[model samples]
Target: MTDISVFPNSLQKLVKAFEEPLPNLEAPPGMPRIKLNEVIGKVAYFYEKLRNSIEFQEEHLLRRNAIERILRRKILLENRNLVDARLLINELIRARYLPNDALPDAIVGVVQNYIDRYIALLDHLKLRRTSPDDRRLIRWLISVASADIEERLSPSVREDALVEVMYATIRNNLVLPESIPTGQEQDILVYLAIHRALIKSDDAILRYHLFRWAYPQWQTPDHAVTEQIKSHFQQLVEAIERRINHPLSERLLVICRQYTIPFLVLADVFKERPGEIRELLTSPEALNDASEKAMTKRIKSAGSRLRRTTVRSIIYIFITKMLLALAIELPYEVYVLRLSNFLPLYINAAFHPVLMAFIGMSAIVPGKKNTQLVVQAVQEIVNPSAPRMVFGKKLKPRPRSRFRVWLFNLAYLLTFVVTFGAIIRLLQYLEFNFVSILIFLFFLSVISFFGMRVRQVVKELTILTRRENLLLLLLTFVSLPILRVGQWFSKKIPKINLFIFILDFVIEAPFKIFVEVVEEWFSFLKEKREEIS
Candidate 1:
């Protein structure tokens, strides 16, 4: 067996985490159970799938989003009591967001206690209820607390340990510029990078993590602790906002992305031999074999993941197009334009989805050489003697020259004109009217950007550094404007998404009540039968 004494400090910490016993969180006896009717549960599951596709969130984020959505629906829309955590928990289980009976009924009380703490803190702060900023802060704090509660209930101990290992490895390897300055700021940069690159956390999750880091006592804050947080609240918010979009984020993200696959490879290797992780990490030959095996498995899975992501994107684009066409184009044609042509509307609905499917299918998966590269990277990560993978970049400011700025802005404008103008001309040639053209262009840009994002799945599997060629440069020049617009739309559109609004506010409330009544009716029937027997 290889010597454990020779392992790196980071690797040793990982081994210790792996070996540590999971904390006991056994449920107390006599707690009630929340059960859902199978037929109703199946319907709810299908509805969730359909609703989620339109939202376009990362897979890892779906659970937390569901929890937040349920909480919002309960507290905001239905005006339900904050302490009715059992009811909320029941709904989550019925919808299959949480597994059936996996969470103890006592968790209901625990969740309520957590909410009460926040409410108490809010009361103490005495922020004006009428103030929009205060209201927003209250909502945000509760949301973050709910998310923390969900994590505590369903702790990912192994995954957390793995992330910690990745963080440590990254912190050691990264070489920041003098401009970044060595302090908590630099540490936060690395932490944020790992969170983004490895786990694919969205803004809400990042906010939660940042809040936790700032106020570790938030979970069980005393009166004094609450007062401290209240005093620092504004500073905390400003600090988080600044760090979320820190100048060096993109730079560090690139480095973290480079290492993500190799770290994932290590995680996979350890997973297969949980009992022998120490031995495997210590043995170079064993670790190499395991890493190679994991890399091969990942490469195979990458193709299937790409297909799934593409199909989801296709469905999302198609559904969104249909909704927009029905909501906007069809009405415009009938009322505003005083025309009845249906062909352009049908084509608009079909084009973007088909294009996305093509883009997804065309993506190339990593091959043997990439796998070898990943295995080598994994070995380097765990091996103490291996040279640290140093990454450094100097932060630079935007051009201050008026002429240079104007010239750059003009070039960007031309790209927009060239890229979009050509598309508009083609649509006009195809007999698409002004309204139809606008809708089509909107979807095209958003779908193109989304398709590019889906292609990142392939990129994640790749260990080899990507080199840009002339063709790529040319393509980027033409597509840059469209992608930029799409990126902007993707962010903004979600805020005012009509479909989500309809589902959340208009449809979901009554539908959930109906499901609950049906469940109650079934329960009543069972009770009658049991009494007669």
Candidate 2:
């Protein structure tokens, strides 16, 4: 074993986390277990898979989304009592969002208690029940509660511990301004950066983090604390809203992404021998061995993840395209255009998925130089003698002359016209009708945006910053306007997603009730057989 005396204090917390036994979750005796019928469970699982395919979300966020959906159905639509939390938990299990028989039955009580506390807090705030702010508050509360439930069901203690260690290490190494106008603490910014880069947290996850920060005792708040929070609830909301989109967040995210590979390498090295982490850090041969192994494993995993994500994206695009064809294209062609031609329809449906597959197949993985950079970065992070990394430089607004601004705007407008104009011209050449051309452009932009996003998997494994070649710059110039449009549509479509609304509101409620009834019938038949036996 290497001497612990030589190791820095920054790593002590991480060492302790790995050395300690993982916390176990046990079920309480005599609490009624919630079970679903096997046949119904299988059906529910299949239905959930189909529903989930409609909305592209990170795989990790699916469970939280499931929780939110179930809660909204039970509480908001069905008006179920918070005490009847077993029904909600049972549905989650039946859908296979949570595992079978793993969660404690008493978790129902925990969920119910959380709902009660949130309701109490809302009442204390005295906001008009039907007001927009109140509704927003309720939605936010539900999202936070759903996230909490997901965590309780499947805790990420090791991940959380790593985040804390990374935060501490980054903070210690980072040089920051003495004071900031943004009013965000440097430590909180560091925490947010780690969550975004390392944990890959989306806005919902970050919002939940902000909620925890705003009300630290939310899990177990007393009357006094509740009252105090009530007085500052509006202010707290505004603060969180501001911080969520703080100007400094993007720069911090870049910095955090820079360190992600190194932190991951360190985690992998320390995973097996928690007690010997200090020794592993000290030994150059061991560190190199571990780094090589980790880099190889990560590259392989990234390839697999890339393929999986690409397949999913293709499937999503194809399904959505077909749905849109049925909803909009077919109707417009038959009624408005009075056309029998379905060639454009066929091409529109197939194009985006084909393009996505092409993008996926063409993507490349990082090389030996990237791995070397990662190893060196990891060494730097662990070595106390390395110089501090400067961070938190204030972003100053650049002043541009009116002529320059106008000229840039004109160039951007021309680029947008040229990009769409070329595509429209091509579609026209192919005998694509006006409606078909519009649909093609719509999916083209959205799919291009998605394709670019999928390409980020390759970037994640790359440690060395890639230099932009002339070809790359040209391609980016052409694609940038389309990507911007895609980004806008991506944000807007979720709010008005017909598929989500239909599944959640139109079909899901009745479908779930039918499943529950079938389960009950199965239970009744089993009881009768037992009695006969």
Candidate 3:
């Protein structure tokens, strides 16, 4: 009660006005609109109260709760319910509430400090679950303490929160959630303000929004976000141009590299802001349409490009394998006499078409292929939406009996080593020469390594279970020598193209047809879905 009396009369009156039922949007009969001087004076007095509450109070949580309320009232007046402020603070200087140029800066200072303290308290409670009852009480205190911070601040802060959540989702390779906002116009002002703040300051949190926006894959950056990225790149280039000396240029180059924004990469970013940015900021529908089109184009092109690369890679592999076989066989014929008893075994092991055919066929299966179900499973693992019960009676930990673990480990090792040893022994039993056995193993290595790469790409698309992980680990041991051989082979034959002639008639035609069929199927499904909707 004593504390209430200390507030300036204007601040006290403003608080009372908020507590009263909201007056009509138009001022009540003769209840004249709030004077600009009164509003400014109240704001000044309110800031002092907020500062004192946060700085001098021993009850940190209570202090934050108080400031939260006061900040909400200021935000409401500043934004004027997301419309223009009718009460002009421009007259505050004449009224002597504040100096001529200091009003706006002072407002920003007070509001920013309040925001900082509120965020600090939030940070302290990170990763800890607050009970629903506690959350409701806190929210009520905040709402009743000030005005509606929940409604006013929520829209502004929500876009940033959505972006952060989306970043986490995509960075972890999860599917985008339907709950995320899809290009709302209300987010535009908040995004621009956040970006402007980022440019003027070195806050890591602010800088991260820019960083995340730069990647177009996960979420398409809006016009405002794109403009800011371009601005950042432009500033970087101008800084490089200002530095005349070689040392300065080198430093600039290092800085550019660290930021992952090279001059060459940014060359076209400054050509022009897209028409999307040129329009009124209020026009979000057009922006969203353009973004959706770009995303569709990107996804479509990726599939086609992937098909083309796969075809080319297959052709390359076929020719390389034939050349490698000839390279090994021709030299042996010249150096050794024909009387060797191992000649038949060597020929079967080194030049058998069946073995080569099997390796080529592996491409058709391409293990670890992605499906919708697999993607959703990975998404759930990364970001489950349901609340988990944490306060139930403590459960016993899963038995980690070492004997069972050791037995499994022992069996895994024996199976791996025995399978590998059996292959070598079979080659020897078949009377394959040491050279022939080595060549056979080299081809096997190539197949294993290729399979490993395919699995790795699939792993990026879906999380693997323990069994799959163990299988991949076993393959890695076999693939290491093959990967080395591939490196050596690449250096030896830097370029080759004979497979183009042979495979075009066999593999290439079928692969192209398959890709076309897939594309057609996707188009048909999309058309049907749109029609049904």
Candidate 4:
């Protein structure tokens, strides 16, 4: 305060100006002395206009474009695109374009048309590959559209929705390379940018407007173009899954997979009620908003599935525990035979019919055979891979299906042993005569396993006949039926057999619990591996 007299007159005026500083600015450090009051006022006015235009105001395409232009220029400048004073000229141009005084209301539509045409032009690039300048224009258009879209960014969406939006963004971005500015391709890219940023925002309503423009036609779809885009989409999903660094990344990968992974059994989804496929994929809340009755029915119908998911999940868990328990409970040979017996059955029943139906599906519906195929096809998926590529590859990993795997193991071992050994044991039990019951039991076991997998199970398991796998399977076949025969004797005998029956019960309970535990544990691991691969 005492130093005012020592300073030059111009410095004195600046000091005075600070006391009555420009309405929107204080003199910044290192700024040269200049009449920047008007400049500050204009800049503040422009920013106020920008904030109001895209998000706060009705989302007129023109106002959106204007705000985007401002953001683009600022972003460019912040990125150090200019090395000279021309940035000043660009700023002046911006100021002129978005002046403070309200423009006439009718002029808004004209500006909107310009904005619309600009956006449309950017969207037309994917099919019309062009030169560098054209690509630059496309990038510029996208940059602007992104600016418009992000004006509404907020934390209003559910974590799941956020995950989906991020996944959607990542999939699209995976295709875009850094040196992507090409002329004829500009429109296509700009279109992509608009939608990418649009969905990223948390606006409750604006998101739908953004999506309707980009989807089906603009954004690459898995369904329509199966070859190029499908593989690419799969790759994108895999890459995202691998590269996920955040918790939400998992959900993102899932959403990406959901879109890329075609429902191998969509007919099952449609079986409930005549409902739009979109309703299932989209929010049920949105569906409810459309019709309360529809919502109630939809929820009521899904209630069974929801309950089943919980119950099945619990059962799967139980089955898994039993499998683990068996590793310790049974002898090595018994384990082998039991596992082998079940695996073939598992593999056979797992994906047999559906795989067959998929292989031989004909548009012309065949005769009565169609029903058989449909029944089988329906069972297969409730019963296996990539609808698209994942990060340049399309390998689908089988999760540890403890239940299915154990079933296959059982099938591999039990079929022949139950059939052949039961007969030998029955001959001893029936006064040296092999009876029909033993033959029937043996035959029944064999037929059951055989019926489940005539083709796939046999094909895959034969290819996977590891020595350890075989050894454990062989043991189970010998042990399980002996246990069964012992139990039969215990049950048939008089009071003295009570101790033998108890012994048999002990053997069976441990075996059952062990199988169930292992089944669930393995399934959990398999699911984890599947997600990664």
RMSD to the hidden true structure, all candidates: 3.4, 3.6, 28.2, 32.5
Q: Give candidate 1 misplaced runs (Cα > 4 Å).
A: 1-5, 20-33, 78-81, 127-130, 172-179, 319-347, 387-410
Q: 374-490, model 1: which lDDT tens digit per residue? A: 777777777746643422222232324778879989999999999889989988888899888888888889888988898888889886777899999998988999999999999
Work out the TM-score per prediction.
0.88, 0.87, 0.29, 0.16
> Would you list the C-alpha lDDT of every candidate in the order shown?
0.77, 0.77, 0.36, 0.35
Candidate 4's TM-score reads 0.16
- Runs in model 2 deviating more than 4 A are 1-10, 26-34, 79-83, 126-129, 169-186, 272-276, 319-331, 339-343, 386-414
Instruction: Point out where model 3 deviates above 4 Å.
Output: 1-328, 337-409, 454-533
**Which 10-residue window in model 2 sums to the lowest lDDT?**
388-397
- Predicted structure 2, TM vs. truth: 0.87
Per-residue alpha-carbon lDDT of candidate 2 for residues 1-533, written as tens digits (9 for 90 to 100):
45566656656666666777666544556645555677789999999998987677777888888888777676556654342567777787888876666667667887677667766776687655357777677666667677777777777676777787677566655544555443347667778878889878776677777888777887789999899888887787777767767777777788678668777777777786677676677787788788888888888988998999899788878888999899999899899988898888899999989999998878999899888878776776677665433222332324468799899999999999998888889898888998788889888888888887888777777766679999999998889999989988888887789888889999999998898889889999999999999
lDDT of 1 at 176: 74
| Candidate 3 residue 440 C-alpha distance from true site, Å | 1.4
Judged by TM-score, which candidate is best?
Answer: 1
